[model samples]
Target: MNTVVSYIKEWQQALQSEIQFLKKFGSNKFLVSNGRLLSTDGSYSYYFETTTSLRIPVGSSVRLEWGSMSQQGRVLSSEGKGVILALEQSFGDLISEATLFHDPWELLDHLIERLDEIKKDKQKRLRVKKLMDPSMPANHPLEKIKSNVHELVLRSKYNPVTFVWGPPGTGKTYTLARTAANKYFQEKRVLILSHSNQAVDVLLGELTDFIQKKDRFREGDVLRYGFGTGERTDNRQAITTTELLQNQDPSLAEEKEKLLEDRKLVKQDIARSFSKRDTNQLLELETKIARVLEKIRQKEIEFVKDAYIVGVTLAKAASDPAIYEKTFDVVIIDEASMAYVPQAAFAAALGKRVIICGDFKQLPPIAASRDSLVTKWLREDIFHRAGVVDWVNDGRLHPHLFLLEEQRRMHPDISAFTNQYIYHSLVGDHESVRKSRNKIVESAPFPNRASILVDTSFTGAYCLTERTSQSRINIWQVLLSFHLIHESYLSGLRSIGYVTPYRAQAQLMELILEDLYQEQRLNADIIAATVHRFQGSERDVMIFDTVEGAPQSRAGMLLTGKDSERLINVAITRTKGKFIHVSNQAFIRRHVFQGKTLRQLVEHQVKQLQTVETKDIGKWIKHQHLKLQWMHARKLENVFQDIETARASIVISLPAHTRLSPEWLEKLNNREKIVKLTVISESEWMELRPDHRVAEGLSFPFIIVDQQFLWLGLPLEGTKEIQPPFVAARLDSEKVSEYLLSQFITRE
Candidate 1:
């Protein structure tokens, strides 16, 4: 037998043995029931019934799995009836740990030893080679990174590992796809891996799209494994490795088709046997189908080994014995920083060259304890470790590591903070980002300010509610987000998101936003998510609600850590157009704030807001020598009051519903001779009802006091009462005011 085949067979046997062990010893089935809580002891007991007579030693760690969720707990007590278990934490924690499996400590140790042996062997050393196509110009958005990737691939011939540092919005996925396509076109077999199935799918989608656009990719050029066939409905031309391999040989395809037809006939026969109650024939047909499936599986493995490119999640690749049988020229791992070291190393072992793309500054691999020595040695990602090592001093980065500098996702002002503070001036500005900044400035209510920090220092504005052991929800922040959302929509920004650090706060904001959406007061498309959940995504406008307000110590505790700084960095960089930080000033001042990036932003916004003097509508009208339009029936008294004090000429367009007495009209007509008051009855305004509400619950009863400021009201349609919760912003541009004016105009 061939060496590779023998090694694969051994690995397969080991996997089977492990599976059998888990089935017999690791997995435990129990009948679970809620136990009564003791009021005096404050201890809640849960009862579990064992399927078989067993001994669950006290203090032993165990996991309870049911209905797509699992929870970690300890055996508090055990008896013949069942065992009592005390949960580690909340129910959600249990669901999160459901994906957690037994650590492959022994396999990882052996792989590391093999890696060491490979590293020490001079004959097995890598030799660097330049890109086969270095003449390809950098024309794509991520072409610079792609070029760097080619260099990395060249270096990978000499080095086992190559790293790409892709900051947020730096087009890491695009670079990975382009590089993979380049290698595939060269007829180099490649294997793509990621810890997340979603990440793998994203890269696969990008590759498929790239292949479809180019003439080089054929039907059987790329094969996707692990992902369901139904999931690729959008790209039906793409086939699995098994199907591609089967298609390569007409004999195999013919045989497979014949077997499939035979299996169908056998199934029909089994149905007939079942209906006739013939158990013998049913069992025989079942055996036949099983044999046919085994043949199909073998054929799939054979085809998979021959594919030019294959994609799978790290977990799938690590467990599937067939993946170990073939050697890949290049192994590209996306989101490598989030992968455990062992998982990434196992995938890397399957290829000669390893190209890893990820941002280590965003989120690290989830672990039970970062302080654990075993976790630090085993779970710390290779990409993350490589990033921390100062390879730039030795000028070795060209061959082994590529740090993508240009960020295209955030406005200059927004990216500047991340560039200066988190990245230490390593990130460069993109020309497109400058254009985006200018465009947002041209339309912003306060165009000069790209970042705004709302001061919730007032008594009621900084209130924080502790909802869980790990989460806190801020009411003031949610309310401020609503106001910002309204303003953002009016500014023509359709894509908006609200990000918070606490899951509870995120849930609360979602509830509030949902209610606003149902009432037609806010856009339903706007998303609210925790910072971790919103990673790898960007929005035109981002409202970050740091739900850490007084008491000062609680807020300090939440914001004073490295993890908190990473969360802040991610939240700040998610905006391409506008960034708003809603937090209490008191909390910000506590302990000088460890992270300089967040501190600088808070100070900048405080200075900007302080420089701009606050002016009400009445005060604004007094300063302008312009025409003012007072519309609506219920707000006429307040409008008249502001107009009485204003120096500007006023034009009042009243709704047809306003039944002004004849005497009042005569007085107004007489006064029109002296005062520059032109009364225009807007007959069409009467036809505008609540059913004409636009976007959220924003209506057309706005007070346009010239082109300086527009006071837009939020009212539920068909309601008699108009609420005071209205958005008042300075209208710096006449085009914006004209847009608002157009909404109230009647068709001629």
Candidate 2:
């Protein structure tokens, strides 16, 4: 199959998805209703201030609409209430107030433009000739992928597209930096770009460190010419473009001042013209201004032309007219999995040779389109779209793909899980991790182990959700987590994270942890967030709250959907020292049988894995025998089996006047053990007694059998004729039943 032909179709789908994303999250999601111009960086861009706190990521494109004038620009930088936008149209004056919009169309337009050019390009050095069969000539041994990135870049003369799959903590960024710096030493122009601004700064910062230590390098040689999230960088001040033009080079600075001053005078002269020949004079003056602007553009280009390494976001490279004028020997995309197809395509076209770096098993581009084709082409990263994932899964390695598995962020045992389960044992941890495994401090529950599965079934921490919301929360689990987190804190593990699939659980933990840390005056570094928010980050200790055990009894859609092993892989592999997974063992096993992603998690954690984080947290572990089923529309026969088989006790929360069936009575009579039973009903219906309890505003229609099995959702005890058409799910875990009983039984 012609991969370029597919990309043409994928390109169209991605544009459509971009439209859908904007339509869905346009005005409300990104609103700058009232903002003012703060300052201008150069003739090409203006710095604006928003009235509200804005979190627009750097390098995002935005639209400014006020009165009859509407313009688009790239956000060069973004701070709390300030954003610097490099607009297509420049203004000498600033507006006190204007409405700014967040539109990604401009970013797509650049990609589309570059894609069209790629389709027309004929050179083998510029574009991949056989995209379906990409190759890297004279590639290094698989063991030296991390060490030989620069050599691969130099050796891949005929091949244009090369991919590097760097899993978490594999030092991909460091490898990228070393490659860029080494290329600089060889006098090769290197352009580094990423999907996010923060990533740009991080890479630029790393690049700065490496180049600064070099004997031949000096300040202003490498420039961080764009906006990133970080307010500060370790790079020298002269590394910025503004610093280079205004301070680093004296001759360029003098020429820029003269041209700008001349342009300013000409604009004033045109504004003052009034004679009958004023039109001619105005045209002449405008011509003068245009000439001076060209001179300024040339000088700016000259300043950039001398730089060996330039770092920016893909949007910046696409939007900045200056970028299209230049070419690079090597183009590197860091965190490429988070990049859209167009971004990668555009960057690929910018350089004769390309290096796309990322872990496809992590986050892909975050788009809101539900179209399957759009999701495949627009949302999936380059590695996925180009069949690297397919080849790897089929036990075959792609010629163009290089793998880096020597990670130092996770323990060897913890890395083994992702190594065996996620990557199919294709790569293993480095010796650093192997040696560091035994150095772990014996923290309370996590003594000498890197990972643990905290089975909530035995701890009475049943999962729960509200009547109206799907964001599940297990209060008992939260409490147990907080206790363990606190223990880890006291044991000197500072970098901790409590991550769950539900926002409600994260928020709840946030509030409690915030209050507790403040109350104790403890300097806590713990973070609680959803699974998606924890990507591209690592922690010394992490608690994976696999919230699943409620009545829904199903795994998360993002966890069980197509190719969802990536997300689950990210969730489980973000910890370095210790990992704790709190989940309902029975629910996942019963309901998570369909998806390969969730099933692998179950088989690996429930059966194969043996290391438990902490034995102390198992204070509530108590195994009890039970049986349960889900019945819909029909109860079949022996509907009262829960009551009939109760050996210890039965807590029936139903109408006081309700009577038992004959089959239940016969079974109870035949049992040798005397079972105690309590009936809970409305206060007005039943008086407070030892056998009969009165409850106010409490739900009752559930029967807790020996505090192990729970009969819930529908009343199957009444006559079959009076039964309503309803669905019911019987929980068979002892801890779940006890937890449910505690929730239903009102003591006050």
Candidate 3:
């Protein structure tokens, strides 16, 4: 058994023994309020209070004793106050909370013992083979999988523990599926696990579809285990092995159908009694339905023992005693980065070969206490810890670790920023993702464009409370994001996602989006979630609201960690076509010294904007009607060649500082005699001050070739550096060219 499960079992036994002892000798008559306990026996009463507000820890079992009856319950609290002391009627009324007390420190002692064992175990060290299978063909099943070279290398290594570093949109699930399928096809029993049931279900669905398409496995070969009733009923494809077994057995299937039908009848009877307000009949029917459901559950568990390939959530799989008896050849853990180290270890202990698939750079494991030593120690996943020392650095990956570089989800525009800032430009570029197939009913103002930055420029205000260090949403940001959503909906671009760093902001956005959805102003399926919640998901368009707007305060504190950088990466990469970042530019600039990813992104956007404005090359080419000329002193031969192709006369100009070869000057002089060639120099042109040049439509060393085409050569000045020392051509603008020529010929 794994250390965590063993510790849990020991704790449970200790709790049970303590409960038995308390029942035998402890006081029965007690009063409880606000998680405080006061024992009262006849005339005497003793109130037990601590220095701090008393809190009953969640998941700790509580037992109550009265007369001949003993009842067990759990403590459910709100802000350290025990709201429901007794919970159920069987547990009786509020009793002494002191009797319910069990220090988790005792539980931690067992956990500490386990941690020590893990630290000392040399067998737990990750091992990898030095060589791969040389006989494997080029067209092997693994090769057919569209994964990166890193993934293929990792799959080749015969490692006890292998890690797949899957950044956002990097096909982590697909890689896991391929690996698991390969193992299964090789006659190896595989156990697939994940942090959440949803993740497990997704992997299971993908695997089942993949194997079915290949005709490699029978219908009952792979089984989904430990899914709850709702999950079993809702997902037909992911029916538990027990359900499949029951269906295959004629007697069991009939009995199960009869129970379901009887339960349905009871539900129908209860619905009818609700109209008549018959309380007794409704109560009896509800009890009948509950009994039938329990029977069905028990029968399902009984048949699950025969499954060959099983998929389950980590906690459920670890807790199942039957799983410990059977060893699998390979255990595949999806979303491994989000699984706590101990939880992952528990899952990893079940298999000889462990494969962990997840992106450590997306989101770390969630923890309850940031200050606790145990919590802090357990926050880092095994995959992340392994990567820290030996994986994916300096263009070389560890033999056992695979870094998936090709992201097939986000558009190149959306992925470029994340690729450069987060992945160090190691991610592969798939140009096909740039074209979004989402149907747009109405074209937005900026339709089918690259990622954009919506610079709010410190227009919003942020709130930070003492209760939490994180900043809350600014009302202005919510309004601005809502406006964007409205515009997106109007433009027919649906599948929008709104992501924020703060929970309060996400909640507010959710409310605003819901209202807009109800009013038919926004898409009904729009999602608003925090960055952590939005990880491992994607959308057609994503709007990020960086809630830190306060410039004077230490707003930088929130975005100053590797985790924050990962959050920013996940947020920006979730969109396929458009990434709309809403942040205060002034605030970001002020705290840019913090070296946060968001600030870096904003700075990149700023540079891109400046480059686009200064060098409007596309705008120049669009207006020039295919008749354009580029002149440079270093490339005079190329310029002469370009001038020779002009159907009409060509005009050439040079600044005072520009020096040309005598051969080029003779070639230009000869061209002047052959065709209408006009050459002008800065000194020969009309003299005008910098301010007057714009009004006169005249620039230094100006030339008007073919009467209709104008080339203005302006020198680089101030902060703007000129390339080629030339301005864009003006085509079909005779008036502007005529004015410049008239002024140039008439020297002052």
State every prediction's TM-score relative to the real structure: 0.58, 0.68, 0.61
Q: In model 3, which regions exceed 4 Å deviation? A: 1-157, 228-238, 241-246, 249-304, 387-390, 393-395, 436-445, 458-471, 519-524, 610-748
Residue pairs in candidate 1 whose N, alpha carbon or C atoms collide under 3 angstroms: 126-158, 127-157, 520-696, 520-697, 521-697
Clashes of each: 5, 1, 1
For residues 621-709, what per-residue lDDT tens digits would candidate 1 score against the true structure?
A: 22221222323333445444443453433333343244445443443334332344423343433232211222222212333444334
Please state the error at residue 696 of candidate 1 in Å. 37
Point out the worst 10-residue segment of candidate 3 by lDDT. 126-135
Root-mean-square deviation per candidate: 17.0, 13.3, 21.3
Q: Which one is best on TM-score?
A: 2
Sort every candidate by lDDT, greatest first.
2, 1, 3
Instruction: Tell me the tens digit of each residue's lDDT in model 3 across 438-465.
Output: 2331145245555667765523233333
* Every candidate's lDDT: 0.56, 0.65, 0.55
Shift of residue 168 alpha carbon in model 2, Å: 2.0
Model 2 residue 77 lDDT score? 49
Tell me the spans in candidate 2 whose CA falls farther than 4 Å from its real position.
1-6, 25-52, 55-101, 117-151, 154-158, 231-238, 242-303, 437-441, 458-470, 518-524, 606-748
TM-score of 2: 0.68
Candidate 1, after superposition: displacement of residue 630 in Å?
A: 22
